[model samples]
Target: MHIGKPHEATTRICQASAETVEVRGRDLCRDLMGRLSFTEYFCLLLTGREPTDNQRCFLDLLLIAIAEHGMMPTVQAARMTLAADPDSLQGALAAGLLGCGPVLVGTSERCGKLLVEAQSRLAAGDDAKVVALQMLQDIRKTGGKLPGFGHPVHRPTDPRAERILELADARGVSGPHIAMARNFRAAAAEVWGKPLVMNVSMPIAAVLLDLDFPVATIKAVPLLARTGGLLAHLAEEQQNPIGFTMAAHAEAAVTYKNTDEGGG
Candidate 1:
């Protein structure tokens, strides 16, 4: 029968059989060469293909841009989950994703769409400045933060946006969309009397549009990249138990009421 033993890696089902198996030792560091940087590694894992150098750089910027933003909802969720009881990194991340539901950390795609719409308005014979200015005005009227314009944390210019724009310029990647983005930046400065340099989402949207990704997908890339940081934070929380406290922040905040309430 020649069935003395079976290899550890192989499994047998209720039968007397021996199987020969071959295994290769993995070199953690060696597997990283030419394997794309962390940014491209994300793409490879998600899209099942390696991104080109430009794509890699773009992906890297996107990942780093939103890697952490001072205990945002996603990070809070991850930490909170970890505090209950330490678990696998993936488990903690899952908790964070639960908190980042569509409304929380989902605006990149909308910003991308805004750029596409801005480009379309310009292409249809409208002045780029006019279109961008009108968009800014509309955002203000609606109490919506202009997605790719100014940043609350960064003044003068968002560092990530500046870097992406520099890379795009160095690569000689000028086009109508890029030109429109520049025009938009100029218009914002003219209206505000100060530079409202592009924010993180701006360059992200610009790069995706340049790469021909649908505007809607631009936001998705951030969500995807931010997961890496979310996972990292969750792992961190497991080591040091401090859950997210945003819910408490939300509950303890103040509220205001309209004074002209005679009609009511």
Candidate 2:
């Protein structure tokens, strides 16, 4: 059976032969191994091109910014999974990464989409502030959330978001996307009654887009960054053995309601 065009397996990322391995058209052993830092290597591997200095610097920055945040739910899930099955380290990592839904480390992707949409509208001569206000109103009208805003824990503002924007300006990389993000900040304060804390996700998305990183691959950065965090947290869980304690706390935090207990 055949459907549409015939499929062929291929990847531009890497190919290995008996003697040498190639990645993004560079020799892994000769060209990339000693010459590139891990962050630069990551950029090359991801985009198939070496990054500019600003790109490499901020790629490293964003990775550090999103890497660890106390015992976030993702880390807790990893720790708890490890506590339940001490031998399955891989499963624990998978469990943690699985928790990176849109509400978690995956939030930057939504923010990326938001920025892209706003940028397209801006390029079409729509005023960024007006677009932000209209979009905020539409989302509010539909009872939907605007991504890159709000946090369950961080208050007043997200300091990491501020720092990222500051660095972007310092590095001369802040562009229209960053401007639009700021416009959202102003529009949010006016439309939402109070200022929603613009979290780190927005800056990460804005800076990367401004630097010309592929819009589609914006999520990969956070996912990769959080994986490093998860590994460290999982190791800590192994040493301190708090996974079960966290589970116990979770159980104690909520009462078990049995509406049908002996009702039959």
lDDT scores of the candidates, listed in order: 0.68, 0.92
Per-residue lDDT of 161-230 in model 2, one digit per residue for the tens? 9999999999899998899999999999999999889999999999999999988889999999999999
Off by over 4 Å in 2: 1-4, 261-264
Please provide, for model 1 over 1-264, each residue's C-alpha lDDT reduced to its tens digit, 9 standing for 90 to 100: 658786566432122225422112222245544554666555544444557777776666667776677777678767766766575567777877766543455556666777888887877898878898888777767787666776667887788778878888888664667777787788777666777767777777777678655564566677776787887776666666567455566557855567696544
Candidate 1 ranges with C-alpha deviation above 4 Å: 1-50, 88-91, 98-105, 141-143, 192-194, 244-264
- Rate residue 119 of model 2 by lDDT: 78
Structure candidate 1, residue pairs in collision: 108-219, 109-219
- Deviation in Å, model 2, residue 201 alpha carbon: 0.5
**What is candidate 1's CA lDDT for residue 153?**
74
True-structure RMSD for candidate 2: 1.8
